[model samples]
Target: MGTTTLIAVAATGLMAGVFFAFSVAVMPGLADLTPEHARGAMRRINARIQNPVFLLVFLGTAVVCGIEVFQGRIAGGLLYVLGCFVLTMAVNVPMNNRLERTDDAYWPEYLRKWTLWNHVRAACCLASTVTLLLGL
Candidate 1:
């Protein structure tokens, strides 16, 4: 694979790991807490996760994947962009925004829905990685 495709594979894999970790570990751990505590912790996490490193990997992966689409790795690139990136922007980020405005009462629904979408994101990234690798 060329450098850009390699980067897309790595970035997508990294993103997949991140979402998987959150789905399997972070969210579950938070579920053990009381709703208020869970909500507070998640709110803080949502805030903190917006930093440079995460944004670089998250947004950068989309950019790399977009480039790959033009470069002919269409399946993998589109999967990441549409399944992961678009879903994130269209669903997860909006949910996060609503979460910021929500009280603890909304936490249960938020947790359920957010984790569900996160699983989808993880799967998309994983599939994107595998598809890119296969195309090579």
Candidate 2:
């Protein structure tokens, strides 16, 4: 694989791992917590996750994937771009934003809904990674 493709693959894998972790482990653990604690923790994590490195991998994958599609070479990356980036901007981030406005009383429903979307995100990203590898 070319260097750029490798980087895109790595970034997609990272994004997939993150979503899967939340879907499989993080939310389950948080589900066991008191509503107040769970909300607070989720809020903190959502805020903290918007750092430079995460942004690099998250946005970087989209950018590279777009390049791949535009170049007509290795179009597999478009999947990651659409699934992780577009869907996130369309759905997950909006929900998270609404989640921030909510009180603990609403956390349970938010958690359930958010995690359900997260499962989609996880599947998409994981599929993106495999698709990219196949393109190689």
Candidate 3:
């Protein structure tokens, strides 16, 4: 049961993280190339997609992983989930919140940090995928 739950949570995290990574990285570059109105529309779309409910779902997956790990199955998978949690809390969330407050003047710099954190997230997601494959 624990292993099953861990795998399920990890899979969800993998998908969300991968999607977020692409959005923060490739999507922004594409947005930059787009016209101003298109960029504004894209930003609005992204904001809607990244609402608190979405964040809760993402965070809830990590919490579920912890519960599964406490049951003594999928230790490595739990580790990866924990890593993702740490990165999210320690880096991504704070940076994102800060970026939200800053004006367009600092957007480029914030975008760089956003991309870097996304890369970190991608690594953690890959780690989770590996853990699932290894069934550790």
Candidate 4:
């Protein structure tokens, strides 16, 4: 595999691990907490997850994978990038912004829906990793 391809697949795999962690551990743990406490924790987490290193991995993988797609392999790069990344920016971020304004009473529904979509993103990231591995 080329350096870019190796980098893309590795970054995507890392992202899948992050998603899986959230789905299996983070979200489930949050479910047991009081809504106000959960919201506070999630708000901090949301901010922390946006650090420079994460962005580089997330977006850098997408950019490299996209190049591979155009080079002829149908790498399924855009599936994860557009599906997971775009959905996060569109649906998840909006919901998170709403949560900041919303009452603690609504946290349950928000958590349920957010986690549901997160699972979808996780699946997409995993799929991206697997397909890229095969392509390599």
Q: What is the lDDT for 38 in model 4?
A: 96
Best by TM-score: 1
What RMSD does model 1 have? 0.9
Clashes of 2: 0
Candidate No. with top lDDT: 1
lDDT of 1 by residue, 1-136 (tens): 8999999999999999999999999999999999999999999999999999999999999999999999999999999999999999999999999988978899999999999999999999999999999982
lDDT of 3 at 112: 67
Give lDDT: candidate 2, residue 86: 89
Question: Which residue pairs clash in candidate 2?
Answer: none
Give the clash total for candidate 1: 0
Alpha-carbon runs more than 4 Å astray in model 2: 73-75
Model 2 lDDT per residue over 37-136, tens place: 9999999999999999999888988988887776654547777877779889998899789889988888988899989988888888888778778873
Task: State the C-alpha lDDT per candidate.
Answer: 0.95, 0.85, 0.61, 0.83
For model 2, give the 10-residue run with minimal summed lDDT.
67-76
**Better model by TM-score: candidate 1 vs candidate 3:** 1
Candidate 4: residue 96 Cα off by (Å): 1.3
- List model 3 lDDT by residue over 112-135, tens digit each: 665666666666666665555555
Q: Which pairs, if any, clash in model 1? A: none
